[model samples]
Structure formats: C-alpha cells, structure tokens
Target: MVRKKLYRSKKKLGQAPGSVVYTGERPKEKLFLEAFDFTKDTYTEKQLTNIEDCFEYKHTETVTWINLNGLNHVNAIETLGKHFDIHHLALEDIVNISHRPKLDDHDSYLFLVLKMLYYNNSHNLVSEQVSFILGKNYVFSFQEAEGDVFNPIRDRIKNAKGRIRSMASDYLLYTLIDAIVDHYFNVIEVLGDKIEDLETDVFTNKSSDNLSIRIQDLKREILRVRRAVFPLREVISKIVKNETNLIQNQTSTYFKDIYDHLTQITENIELHREIIGGLMSMYLTSISNKMNEVMKVLTIMASIFIPLTFIAGVYGMNFKYMPELEFKYGYFAIWGLMVIVFLVLLFYFKRKKWL
Candidate 1:
C-alpha cells in the first residue's frame, strides 16, 4: 500500500474532536464494500456497489461482515458510521489511520483499531490501519486499501470448512484478527531471514558497502513492527477482559489466543531489535579492526624504511667527507651492509611475530 507521512496535517489541526478526516496517503478512490452473511446452515456473499446495500444486514439474524476498503472517502465512512450508530470518534479514528491499536466498548458495539502488517509487492513491510466495529449480529471492518490478510477467513467461510461459519460475529472478529496476527509470523520470519543474512555479512566480512544502511533499515523495520504489535497486546487483553455482550465468553478464549500470539510477536520484535543493535556494533568494530590492520601495515613499512632512509640520507649528503665514501668498494660495501641490515630486521620481525 502507498503510504504518506502520518503526522496530522493542517487540514485536521484544531478541528473539533471526532471530526472525520482522511489522514492517509491513499487518494480519493471509489470505496469497495464486500458483505458476507453466514450461519450454520446458510451463506451468502455480495460485492456491494452501493454503501446502502450492506446497511440492511445490520438487522439480519445471520452473522454479517461488512468490509469497507478506502477510508480516504470520508463521506462514505461517515454515512456508514451514521447508519451503524458508530460514534463520531470511532469514525474519526478509522479515517485517521495513525491511531495505535485500541479497543473501545460502546453501548451497542465494540470499536477496535489494529495495525495490519503485510509485505507489499516490493517486499517492504507495510502497516495499514484496520478498524473493527463488532455489534449484535454484524461486524464492520474498515481499511485503507482493498487487499487484506483475511482471505483465509473468507475461504473458511465460503467452504464451511471451519467453525467460523457456525459461530457468532465475535468469533468472526477473532478469526479476522487471528489472520492478521498469524501473518505476523510470516513477517517476522522474513525479518529473521534478513537479520541472519546481515549477521553473516558482518561476521564473514562480506557485507555490502551499505551494510550500515541495511542494518539501520532493519532496525527501523523492527521498531515499526514493535509499534504496531505491542499496543495490540493490550487491545487483545481488553477484548478478553471486556464485559461487553458483543464479545462472547467463549470467543474470549480465541481472543486470548490472539493475545498470546501478540506476546510472542513482541518478544520476537525485541529480540530482533537487540540483534540489530549488536549487528551495528559488530559492523563498527569490524570497520575499526580493518582500519587498524591498514594502519599496522603502514606502521610496519615505515619502521622498516626508517634505518634505510637514514643510510640513504647520510650518503646523499654533498660533502665528500666520509672515509667510507672515499673507499674504493664503498658503494658495494654499503649495498651489502644495507642488505644485511634489511635481512636482519626482517628476521627479527618474523621472530617477534610482528610480520
């Protein structure tokens, strides 16, 4: 999904609380709505072209899932919120995708905001906001885009392969959230692979020129996942502890499972963060050791040349001065002496293990 800076803009600044504003990067696209109504004995799915199409499902006896993609359309969201009796604040948070994961129990429904994580086509982690409103027989889901991690749930509902079709809307909510949480495993696995690759590069001295950059990017990705996954733990906890009739006691067990998954995900995120930190330090140490090696070689070369340079300097003097210079074989003698000194120093260096 295309993303923009989530920082609030002047458009929403100073606005009344609960004002519905589109704070996401997605452009004004036509909203997509899909309705799934199912019970133990029956199932139906519809591609709703009109927002009003799914409005009647609110009164239906069967469990209904009304999913809307395209929070950029404030009018549609507001209309749906009004039809469903969703609080203005809830609608506000839905469009303003910056809200962290949270749960608000309303008189007639439960409003939940969660960060949906997935790898986009570029294989980059993307955090999209998905809001859920759970009511008597209906659950409303809002998103910034069309695709989601709920396809498996859809298949389950369609094929009647699981308890989802026979369960209440609360179970449906659990499944949806479970799907997102399950995808976290996939995302974390990808991140783990990346960390291993970078770790190998750092250890084997085969890292790219942008190794630091890659490590920093990995750090950022971990942090982003942290921000997305940590708060969700609390959200699931709230659901499990919620006294609202919308969340059935049996369904609470499923939510508790989600909480456990979030805990695991958070732990993995923290571990990855520490690993990234270590990778950074290792990279710096490697660079420093490499520089030290270069300097050591340079220092040894200078040490070897010092005596040779002195001899050359002494002979380079203009004065005819020296008895050594006056000797007939001085040139050959000097050459032999310098060669012997060079060999002696070389052997000494070898013996000292300095070479």
Candidate 2:
C-alpha cells in the first residue's frame, strides 16, 4: 500500500523567502516555449526555443499566452521572471513544483499553482505541476514537462472554434484551467473501468491473489487525486469572489463553472473511495464466511464419527474371555446393531438440520 506522503518542506527550511528552488520532479526533456497572440479579430502563434522571443509582447495590450514546457531550466525561468516583473516569490513557486494548489494575488497579476493530471500509456495516473501568471494583457503558463493535457484549449485557439479567441486574458486563464480540470474525467473513467474488473475479481468464487495490491494502489491514487482537487475549489472561489482584480466580472462566471466541475470531481472521488472501502470489508467478510463454512463441515463429520469410533474401539479390544466374541452370530448381530444406530443418529441430526 502506498501511503500519502507529506510534502517535505525541508529544502527551503533555512532559506530566505522568495528563494527559488526546484522542489518536485527533475525532467530530462529540453524546454520548449510556445506563444499565442490573439484578439477579437486577429490570431498569431509561434514556437520559440529562446525566451527572448516572448519579450516583444510583454507590454502589449493584445492578449498573449506564453507556454513554457519544462521547469528544469532555471535560467530560462529567471529570464521570463525578469521580463514580466513577476515577484520573486511567484518565481520561487513556479520552480518549486511541489507547491500545492494555491493562488497568490498581487496588484498587477494573479499567480496560481495547479496540479495537472494525466494518464500515461500504461494507464497509470500522473500529476504535473502547472503554474500560471495572469497579467493585464498576457498570461504565462509554466509546466513541468513537454506534453500536457491542454490539447483541447490548443485546438480551440488553433481552429478559432470557440469564443476563447474573443475573450480577455482572465477568460483565457479560466478556459485553460477548465481544460486541465476536464482531464480528470478521463482519469476517473479509466479508473472506473479498472474498479469494475476489481469488483468482479473480488466478488467471484476464485479470488485473485493480486486483488489486495490493486485495491491499495487504486485507493492511493484516489486519495492523491482528492488531495489535488479539494484545494482547487478554494482556488477558483478566490477568483469568483474577486479577491484579485486580474479576473474581470464577466470572466468570474466561467470560473464558477470550473468550480462546479471541481466539485463534481471531488464528489466522484469520494464516492469511489467509499466503494473501494466497502469492497475491502466485503473481501474480509467473504473470507471469514468461507472459513466458517469449512469449519462447520469438518465439525459435522467429526460429530457423526465419534459414536462409531467408540463402538469400533469397544469391539477391537484384546480380551480372551469376552462372551460376545465367542458367539457365532455375534459379528452379524453387532453389524445390524451398528447399522440401526447410524440410521437413528442420522435421522435425529437431519431433523435438527445439522446433517
């Protein structure tokens, strides 16, 4: 069983606040930066390996989205941090991917840290830390790795399929968060299917030796997901409640929609956890019942054989002057008597429902 681990904050224990440190995973993939600039009537996209390419849109009123795929490159993060004038603490949080789901509100922008969930090819649940800085006319999205669960939002921007192109930076932020939250549904669906298989294995006559391990793994994953999603409600409500001016009134409703989805995800996770717990209890109970049935059968056989064993012992005794042993019909008589005794005991036991 995998237990939930406490985020060890020891790395920053003696360090000063705003000190930048990479706290979570260390990836080997090279960093890739993608910039999307769009408006109600215009759209532009670029893929640049250099951070300097994004500097031109730093002060522009045209909504620009900068997505950096890897966080292992600390120098690259510092360059963008300098350009945007992002606070040292925000930069620190960006690099320290272990930071939980939280929102840090500043006057010019809102900094948010989120957990992006995805499933690998093996259907194992994977979590990546994604941080966002929502500025007046620009937003910076920092991710821990190259591939992401944001293809829907990318497709939307590429195809002009939705109102996202016409929306402001805050709406774009909400839309992107919604995209990440929507990925949870796929994880849940895949896990739900696995749970169905586990249910059969658990309830079937043939027990799987690996059932316990799979249950523990699933439970641990569910708990991890719940931990990531529960705090997201507060993160979105901070926006909906307008704690930061970066989120406009019109865009607040969209955040509320995201909050609703987070709520549904949380409820589903909790329900699954309950079912898994019930399955555990049922497994134990089923084993107990099986043992009891076996014991009852053994006990019944012993009861039926006790008197017969006594009669056999009485006749098998070594004695030379026993009167019954000398009689010619003694063997037949004893056999008839033993048969009568067995039938009478059988009848009594059957009547008492113990047969």
The candidate that achieves the highest lDDT relative to the unseen native structure = 1
The residue-by-residue lDDT of candidate 2 on 111-187, one tens digit each, is: 99999998988777888889999999998999877788778888888888889988899988988898899998888
Candidate whose TM-score is highest: 1
Where model 1 places Cα greater than 4 Å from the true spot, the runs are 1-8
Off by over 4 Å in 2: 1-16, 319-324, 327-349
TM-score of every model? 0.95, 0.88
Error of 1 at 342 (Å): 2.0
lDDT of 1 at 244: 79
Model 1 lDDT per residue over 215-315, tens place = 98889888889998988888888778966778889889888888888888888998998899999999999999989989978988888889988998998
lDDT of 2 at 211: 71
TM-score: model 1 vs. ground truth: 0.95
The residue pairs in collision within model 1 are none
